[model samples]
Target: MYLAKRLSIQLLVLISVVTQQTTAQPLSNKRLEVSEKHLLTDLITEAISRDEWMDANQLFVSSLQAESIKSGELDNLKLSLGLANMPIDSLDFNQEAMTQLKFSVSQMLPRGDSLALKKETWQQKGQVALVQQYQRAAQIERDVSLTWLAIFEAKQSIALIEANRGLFEQLLEVSQASYSSALGRTSQGDIIKAELELIRLEDRLASLALIEQAKYAQLGHWLGDLESWPEPNSLPQVALKQARFYPADPVHFDDKSHLDNKGHLDEKTQTPNHSITDQTLSKQFVQHPNLIELDEKAQLAQVSMSLAKQAYQPQWGLNASYGYRDDAENGMPRSDFLSLGVTLDMPIFSKTAQDAGVKSKQLALNAIAFEQALALKQMLAKYRVIQSKVAKLNQRHHLYQSSLIPQLKQQEDIFLAAYKSNEGPFSDVIKARIESLNAKIQALVISVALQKQKVEFNYLFATSNDFLLGADLVAPMSSY
Candidate 1:
């Protein structure tokens, strides 16, 4: 009766351990709560607000505004005051000596719309600065999202290992009790194996804890010392913006349709169309802030070239002078003299310098055009690569969800049941449990990877239009 009662207690412990292991579920299935989404948004907003790059860009824009204003008005007008035609001796300061105090003002008129072109160039530069600010914001959003996802992945992985560790501990206790009681098939070897598995779980948890800590440190660059920040509770749901050039079949946060009965993507499943024409991509890229930034730079260069070409025209200056003459020593009144003059400087002798300036500006404009073309091609390539990766990750995630994880769970159950009935080795049961745990962790990894790729894919089409107006980046002048 004592042996029978001891056997019944061991069986109950084994059953409890098996039930706990089998009931463990992956964390990937949990949707990001609304509060969590708001938390992520707030983090992104804080990061952007504190970004020094935005402040630098704003400073540049302000400088450009000052230049635009300077070029638009008579800021270059010159004035002079001096003694003119004064005699060397006081005795010579008579009516015929013509000694006088003179004041003169001269205004150099910019040649052929040059002032307008200069103003336009500065304004275009301001636009580029504004676009760059938007680009910085987009980059910040992507970095923060990726870092947060890394933290989430590490946290989830640690949770899975810890949960499985508890089950392993229970199993270890069962093995030790059974071995001591000389019951079931538990041997000293089984006890050693259970202890080894528990130690491995501990090792894994330590490594993952370090990884989570490192990710938090990286996130601190944007969030500023996460000592007070709560650990991320859920993964943010990265939604792909529906851009016109985006693939027709975008992966969604809850999408499961691509998989078939065999846990594979359906042969008929339409993948992202890699054959999107350059023309279509160009249309989209043209609107992207990156390309728009280059376009503004190119426009600035063109205006600069036009301003340089003005050097070929005559430079004109208008001057007016008023001379107040002192009365003659003999008490005769002296007349106040007014003088007006126009000055012209032709570029006849400066052809070489003028041509060089215009050519340099033209070369810069051409360089900007090449840069823009290269940028477009690079963007297209990146989009295709990210699209393919997202599609493949989706398929892998589905395989784990629809087949691999379920099969592993079943295998674990079969092994546990066999061990319970004395038909399988305890080693098989341990192996099955480890396999199930690893598979769930891998599935969570794939989900995180998929979301990260989607973030990049969406960023390919990110624009400044939404925030540009709000930033008050209007051009200083309407026309050149």
Candidate 2:
């Protein structure tokens, strides 16, 4: 029992120490990058949520409903007057006998099915607008994410380049010192080479900085302000251990390749080895917003056709009124009278017009159906290509991470060690370093491109009612 109590106390002490260490640790670049992604996502969704286009669509829907309501009601209703035997005899004392008065009302009513068809068409149109709005919002979010990734990649290049520049500067100093020393083996040519390399690095840094600025400007265009862009610390860290050399390789120290500023390679490639299948993607293709919008349009055209056919039916109306009339041809008290009317507007004379309208609406519906089918075919083809590309790119990214980068890193370390020991030429070390830098840059570029593919894929596949708006702009990344 005594031992157990002592062990418990020891565990408590360990927990306290760990808590203190954790509290003292600074925020990491990974966490800051996540925060920045969240901020961008929030801004994009907010912009979409407040878009004027959405309001315009909503107003249009309201207008359609209003029109339907107005059409369903009586087209004409009025209080009317009737006068007879007025003022024909001049200077007649009995003018009251020459005057007769009555009051009546008349109205015209719309066809019955016309209002119902309008309501149906309105509903279909509203659905189309809603889907279109969701698609537009998704497009905006996708664009913002792409811009964010671009900026992240630009910043990463700048960091890697700047690190290389520092290395070159140190090497330049060493070469200059060795060249000037009496009895030193380093020649004036080595010093000159180092100076030229340093100058080249400086120029490259300036160019990369400009690229970074342009990327930042693109991000700012979406985010609405350059001043509020996240600080450098909030960017993905390009200096992760992944960018460094691997400690294991069988190569000799004397022979290694160094990377240079010009080692930039195009990173765009296809991905490979995803678990999804074409069959699954095909099943989801019909649910795409563009196709769904087309379906809604078809439904609206069908409703229009129905309304046109309805025009062949007679339009009906009624007029009814109560009248107060003076006694006719007698000096007696007035009597009230109630009158009723029924009017029918038969299409017998305009049957051809109604048939023509029906034909037009039917053609419109057929056109919509054809367009929907075409869109489905096109979307399926497009997604299939994208899937193949993404799969190949995935394979390439794996190759870089698991093979190429580690090999280059080993080469850099080998040349670097030999150069420091003065047993190897400085040029060999620069070559190896440049090669290593190129490998790292290649990895970074491909990583960013993969993320972009993910954004686009999600935009295409997403079908949530809220359309997955305001979600994380990027997946949690460990490094740039």
Candidate 3:
């Protein structure tokens, strides 16, 4: 009677376990929806729409190309005019205006003094132009650098996920082998259930891993090389030394900023550079030092406008001079003369010359005006909006650091010990494993998001010295 009852109990337990296993359904642990990997490069590449940065980058490159052409043209002009042959000091053949300017100034000043003033102006204008070009190049470099950083992050995520999947696979096999052998000591029902759960987790890991290649492909698209991807552990930790939080209108923060920058990063990009950037004239450029170059543009324009009017003015002068024969006894003055004259010249006002002058000034004014307007608009509208959204992310930082990580760690410990015993229902162990994995991924998502925000914050608010690290607004390689 006792042996029959024990056999009946075992049979009933096995049947109930099988029914539960069949009904519970295997849960694949894939992380769906959006996460930081998207922000890293995939989404940013899309959100960063190739507009102004592309245009500005192209503008800087074209500026260089245009400069080369201008340099060639100026050299040609000097050859044609015979101006290059004479030293700048040599006013060998002056136009009516230049002649009058020299003569008039001569009475009050030495010839060297007149030449020095005009020469200084010309050299200074050229200097400003060179400086502007350098800054533009620096800014373009920075844009490419930051965009590529996003690519780096995406690659890192894929590697980490793959590593995690591999670890899970190894662990799954160990758990399965232990379960099959311990079946008598362990409940057969529990062992079978553990086997099934491990299968589900394995499937989940495989699915997640499949996407790793996709992420790798995206990285290759940016860098044109996959093996060149720097090892994940080797990446330099980018630090945010001192972040001066972007102050935004509280009205928008209370209302729209959340809608704009919250929930998803792709949406925040819409705020535009004019909306998101607090691009004060006072705002210094560092990482994207191209902003500094804009000042040089305005400076050059003003100088060119001054130079264009050079032909329009009259110059009057008087000179009292004496020349002595160097070899004469007692250095006797051989010739002495006193001459005074008033010279007046007026521009004939050729529509061509006049029109050229007007057009040049107008174009310079337009460039300065466009850049200024765009910077200001970004600061007031787009950047401010972004700033608010970024702030929200910061507010969540503590929640992750203080609360989530520790709790997940504690759960991992509890589950780890239980699984080793092979005594607990396998479903309990599976639940613990799944929860821990979810928590780990969530932590990564938070970390990646915060890091990305830090990068963007530096990009928006960083000063001129900061850009020294990666400050090429336009890439020289692309230009080449």
Candidate 4:
């Protein structure tokens, strides 16, 4: 018994110590990142919980029952038959309660009307819930983008390293050959230069290895598994012909307009028009990633207004209770009667608050209008910027493809031929090779940047049709 008690005490002490360490430990930047991720994960999990395919009819029924329980709204009716109208002994509170119940039932939900209205109300609520689902979906998409961006970048860096590896192999062979030829000809200076080249190649390889390790570490953290990481099969090849860009100008975009910004939001703010999908440029407006949420919210605000008006009106419900009172011939009490009743209390006190609530909801609707305007304005600004960038990149791509790149390729070819014929300095051949590598690398970087910009622009401005296909094209192109 003594030993068990001691052990229990030790366990308690250990738990307390652990708790203290957890609470008192200084928060570092690393811990903050972890906390943020956990919060995000939890929010997504909760939002998904609310997204279960609940039956609207059943939920509305349940919600009405819940409201009855919460507000005690149905049980507030009382009997007031007037003191002179009924003698004290003859006044049966139970009879008055029964009459109130009958009146409330016929007035509130009215038996035959409930089923259809219940279904309709919940269906509208479901749309609002679905809007929340879309926002949640967007968050999940953002997470995926973060993870894949890390992986793509990792693969991209690996490809650069692979390219550098090939450079090293060729450099090593040239150095070895130069060293051999120099020693055979008794040329000490050339041998020294070859040794220096070998040393530089080793340094480059080491640096590339470091970069690969860092990228692997980043990917591992995202996946929540330190031991596993993405193993790229091969470096990606660019398919310039498959590129699809978002509209450059959101102010005057058409069906073929590239995604420049989230301009669809303005359509609704300008007009709370029903059938948002049937409006101008209907295809672009239907379930657009950026605007659907706002439009649904506006619809929900209208529902709230309706609910507020309903709150001002009376409601009906039934109640049953059993009670016992002291009423016995032998001076004792016994169980007497089981009472059943229902009520409809006037909204004399509640109408004021209901009015305030309606006004508050109206203000919220106005706020959403302002928010829609802000989103459109910001999107337009973004669209203009991306358009400028896309134009500049296209111009540069054409200039390099047509003029500079072709001349650089010819120069490399001429230098190779001259070197083979022993008519050019070896250093001149090396310079030509370096220039060509730089040009190719620069071109590759710009091409990737163009795609990255397009992906961001498209995500914010894409039409409903610009979905998975857009993702597919942007996916490979996004590997920065």
Number of the predicted model whose lDDT against the real structure is largest: 1
After superposition on all CA atoms, what RMSD does each candidate show versus the true structure? Answer: 9.2, 14.4, 17.5, 15.9
1-480 in candidate 3: lDDT tens per residue? 533543554454344323323322234233123243332332223222322444454455445545544433211111111122222565443321222211112332222233333444454454554454444433443354454444344445544544554555555556556657764234556555655554554444444434433444443333332232232332323344233434543323222333423233245443432432334423443233445456656665665566556545443344332221122235433332234544344456554786688678868768897996676556445345555555555434444455666666677667667666754544565566656666655655555565554555445444444222123332222110
| Per-residue accuracy of model 2 over 108-165 as CA lDDT, tens digit each | 6656588777767776666676677667666666776677677677667767877786
Q: Could you give me the TM-score of model 3 versus the true structure? A: 0.45
What is the C-alpha RMSD, rounded to one decimal, of candidate 2?
A: 14.4
Ranking by TM-score: 1, 2, 4, 3
Q: Model 4 scores what on Cα lDDT?
A: 0.45
Alpha-carbon lDDT of model 2? 0.60
lDDT of each: 0.74, 0.60, 0.44, 0.45
Q: What is the lDDT of candidate 1?
A: 0.74
Of models 1 and 4, which has the larger lDDT?
Answer: 1
- How many residue pairs of model 1 clash at the backbone? 0
Candidate 1 worst ten-residue window by lDDT:
471-480
TM-score of each: 0.82, 0.70, 0.45, 0.50
